[model samples]
Target chain A: MDVFEAVAEPTRRHLISLLAERERTAGELVDSLPALTQPAVSRHLRILRETGLVEVRPDGQRRIYALKPDGLQRIDDWITPYRRFWRDHLAALEQHLENQ
Target chain B: MDVFEAVAEPTRRHLISLLAERERTAGELVDSLPALTQPAVSRHLRILRETGLVEVRPDGQRRIYALKPDGLQRIDDWITPYRRFWRDHLAALEQHLENQ
Candidate 1:
C-alpha cells in the first residue's frame, strides 16, 4: 500500500501522528489507544511498516517503531504542486483579512 | 470520504493533479484520460466532488471541475507534525553533505 492508502484509515493516521512525536513500542502504542485491540494496532503497524512510513527495530524482545521521516517525501512531493495553489489562495485570503 | 481516502486511488490522484493545473470540463478530463471510459471518469469526478477535493459547476452543457485548494488542508494539517520531524532530519543530512 502507498502512503496515501496507508494513511486513509483513521487508526493508521493516528498511529503515524503518534510515531512522529517519538519512537514507541507496540505495547506503548497499544496502551495509548485503548479503543483498539492489540491485534488491530499490530495490523496497522504492519501496514505502516510495509508502506515504509514506519521503521521497526527489534530491541531485545520488544520491537520499537519510529517514523521514517523521509518515507513521507513521496506524498509530500505529490502535494508540492497543490501547495503552490494553496499558497496563492492563502495569500489572497490573508490580504482580504488584512483589508478587513 | 476524507481527502486521503479520496486520493488513495491513483486515478483520482491523477485527476486532482490535472485539475490543479486548470479547471477542465468533463469532456476535457475524459479526453485527457483516454484509458478510462467516460462513465468511469464521471464517477471519479463525482467522488472528487463529494470529497470536496474538486468543486464542479455547470458551464453550458459541460461540467467544469476545479481543485478546491483548501479541501486538502486536512491532510496537510495532519502531516504538519511530521514536517517538523522531516525538517530536522533534512537539516542534519544537509550538514552531513556539506561536511563531505
Candidate 2:
C-alpha cells in the first residue's frame, strides 16, 4: 500500500496522529481508540506498517509503533509548493483584521 | 461529504496535487488526467469541491478550480505537534554524519 492508500482511511490517519506525539505499544494504541475493537485497530496498524507510514520496534512481548517521518515526506513535498497560497491568504486576513 | 470521505479516493488527491501549483479549468484538469475519462474527473472534482478542499470560480465558458488551503488546515494542525520528531531525528542524523 502506498501513502495515498494508507492515509485514505480516517482510522489510519487518526492512528498516525496519535503516533505523531510518541511511540506506543499496540495495546496502548488500542486503548486510545476506545470505540474501535483491538482487531480493527490491528488491521489499521497493519496497513500503516505496509505503507511505510509507521514502523514498529519489538520490546519484549510488546511492539512499539512510531511515525516514520520519511513516510510523510511525500505529502510534505506535495504541499511545499502550495504553502505560499495559504501563508499569503493568512497574511492578508491578518492585515484586514488589523485595519478593522 | 466530510474531508475524510472526500480525500479517501486517490484520484481526488492527485487532483488536489495538480491544483496545488495553480488553478486550472475543468477541461484543463481533465486533459491532465488522460487516463481518466472526463466524466470521472468531473466526479472527482465534484467531490473535492464539495469537501471544501477546492473552490471553483466561473470564468466565462470555463470553471477554474483552485486549492482551498483552509480545508487542509486540519491536517496541518494534526501534523504540527509531530514536526519536532522529524526535525530532531534529522538533526541527530546530520550530527552523526558530520562526526563520520
First chain TM-score in every candidate? 0.87, 0.78
- Alpha-carbon lDDT, every model: 0.88, 0.83
Record all residue pairs in model 1 with backbone atoms less than 3 Å apart, i.e. clashing: none
Q: What is the lDDT of residue A35 in candidate 2?
A: 97
Which lDDT tens digits does candidate 2 get at residues A1-100? 6776677687888898888867899999999999999999999999999888899999999999999877877666655676777788899999999999
Which CAPRI level is candidate 2?
A: acceptable
Question: Per-residue alpha-carbon lDDT of model 2 for B1-100, expressed as tens digits?
Answer: 6775676577887898889878999999999999999999999999888878899999999999999978776655655676776788799999999999
Supply the TM-score for candidate 2: 0.82
Error of 2 at A75 (Å): 1.7
lDDT by residue (B1-100, candidate 1, tens digit) is 7778899999999988898879999999999999999999999998998888989899999899999978777777767667877788899999999999
RMSD of 1: 1.9
The fraction of reference A/B contacts recovered in model 2 reads 0.26
